[model samples]
Target: MATEALAVRQAVPGDFAGWLPLWHGYNEFYGRAGDSAPPASLTEATWERFFDGMEPMEALVAELEGRLVGLAHIIFHRNTGLVGPTCYLQDLFAAPEIRGRGIGRALIEGVYARARAAGARRVYWHTHESNAVAQRLYDGVAERSGFIVYRQDL
Candidate 1:
């Protein structure tokens, strides 16, 4: 499939129905399904943030033949080391059936364009070390930061 046929653009309210499945799949890929799935309130808030101008978050969707096949969510924030805001690609996912047709690449390029337009100096994201497939795509499009990730549940 020619990536040219894929339309990568800001997601609209109408896209929620199509976007939810991909969002769930992304979570499930990381073992966040069922008992560990994110709460509905959090999901609802995330969606609302994308449309709120006061928020620093945004969402992009990839549509092929009018069906959404992928999604990218980004956040822009001030960084102590950067003069300009940095763009963090919080989440990126393409449907399993359409993994290698350039949907992921196209959505990433879309994020880059958006980040550049937003006066961001850089764009970055993280993936589970075990996700070699996604890493393959990430490696081709962006450099590995070589930083280990750590977290503590509040």
Candidate 2:
């Protein structure tokens, strides 16, 4: 931040080189260590979509000295009884070494800005029940809905 080093820009195919590690790190933090990531094919497809200009998925990367240090993936989804599509923050991550250095905050703030620009009625995301580190930051930036998420594979 000495020189305002972080720049959040729309991700492109070429950014895959910088984003893959952060993406994997994000997944790992969610407790998926092995065979837990979206298939490589899906990752490839996602990279392509980020630059397609027509896809609803949007991603931004935070770069410093031309190196990607953080990322945020966002999407708009329909919600019944909502006045407009809700903006969901699908993922947010920063390099472990750079965490608490405000990079993660920057990525999330960027997501908020994108959502507002897209005319979204609201923006939100969920973290694991025990993710204390993320919760600390989430508590500061947004209100907790007190909802417990349930998931079933297959």
Candidate 3:
């Protein structure tokens, strides 16, 4: 596959149909599918966020041969450690068959470009400890912060 030909761009309203499957696959990879899946309300809100100018969330899609092959959702927020906003790449996924072909890298790089344009100080994201394949790619592009994440449901 010639990854050089693929294009990454901000997602548009017409992309919802193609982006849905990729969204489900991403959630399933994280054990959030089927009975444990998020409610439709949450999904709707997420999609809405991408189109809402008032929201700091944005989504990028990878297109090749007129087909959507990947998706990345990014969020810009203020952080106490930085004077500028930080970009949080909340979700990233490339089609199973297209993994390792540079689609993921393109999407991440796309996010980085967008962050830079938005005056964000940094772009960061986390993956499951078991996702070594993804880690290999991530390691090449960004340094790991060595910070452990902790969370509790209220």
**Best of the candidates, TM-score:** 3
Give Cα distance to truth, residue 21, candidate 3, Å: 0.4
Q: Positional deviation of 132 in candidate 1, in angstroms?
A: 0.7
Stretches of candidate 1 exceeding 4 Å from the true structure: none
- Go through the candidates in order and give the clash count of each: 0, 0, 0
**Which model, 1 or 3, shows the larger TM-score?**
3
- Writing each residue's lDDT as its tens digit, candidate 3 over 70-108 gives 999999999999999999999999999888799999999
Of 1 and 2, which scores higher on TM-score?
1
Error of 2 at 112 (Å): 0.7
Ranking by TM-score: 3, 1, 2
Q: Write candidate 1's Cα lDDT for 110-141 as tens digits.
A: 99999999999899998887889889999999
What's the TM-score of every candidate structure? Answer: 0.96, 0.90, 0.97
Error of 2 at 120 (Å): 0.6
Which 10-residue window of candidate 1 scores lowest in summed lDDT? Answer: 1-10
lDDT for model 1? 0.94
